[model samples]
Target: MRSLTESDIRTSFVNCSKGEAQRLSVPRDLGQLPWADLDFLGWRDPGAPDRSCLVAEWRGGLLGVTLRFPPSRRGLRHRSMCSLCLTTHPGGGVSLMTARKAGAAGREGNSVGLYLCTDLACSLYVRGRKVPESGGRLEESLTLDQQIARTTGHLSAFLDKLYA
Candidate 1:
């Protein structure tokens, strides 16, 4: 994958906000990534649980999406999927992730909780950077490049809604 410039990221947001495009993400170097396989890009904020992000590429541009994880008293439910890794769990591995809405329409606090893979592997998911599993070869269908692009697209759309 190619590294994305700040302008590229900003432009993606603009396009998605206008409903002219889908979401995308900031591109990072995929040299160290497993380029031969991947499906999406996913990552959690190192500093905040409430701040997680994803990105993907679509058409010819990048899409970045951000999500907010509010603290919830309800226990996590089973059979949830991680937005970043696409991993589904039968137990409490997923949480609700909400994206902000665009424009004045979202001025009143609107968000969504997407059941996500508990192991935030957006980066590995998109770039095929995975830890060796003891059992067998992990599902590696899409190339790392495709994973990054798809992740970026999803992310960009999500962020646009949040700030919109």
Candidate 2:
């Protein structure tokens, strides 16, 4: 994925209001981020632990999504797989994240949910840059390119649900 500017990150959210997007925080070390290595950028809000964000280059433009999860990660320790990258986290490192649907459906409280990495780092996990404390790994039959494709497809499907 290409590196993104603050404006690109803030204005790309399709499911949030302009004010909400403006109030959301962007990563401080944009310049230092490993952009070329990521399929998408994702992070949990430091100030608001329950809030998270994901940004990716979609179609011909940038697509950002705001996500929310339960505040307490208590008792989530077991072998589970991230829906986005299919990586198994032995410490129950997955969180069920929900994205509010775009437009009126969102206004009416509709949302889509999926299990994802608690830290929102599916890209890093898939590429082996980051791993759970227990050390995560996928089956050998899947190549790195195949893993990338699955992760990208999962994210794209999630985005599609947001606008659908």
lDDT of each: 0.50, 0.85
User: Which portions of model 2 miss their true places by more than 4 Å?
Assistant: 72-77
**Index of the highest-TM-score prediction:** 2
lDDT of 2 by residue, 109-150 (tens): 999999988887788888889877677676568888988998
* TM-scores of the candidates in the order shown: 0.50, 0.93
Q: Which stretches of candidate 1 lie over 4 Å from their true place?
A: 1-31, 35-39, 71-79, 82-86, 90-92, 122-164
lDDT of 2 at 10: 96
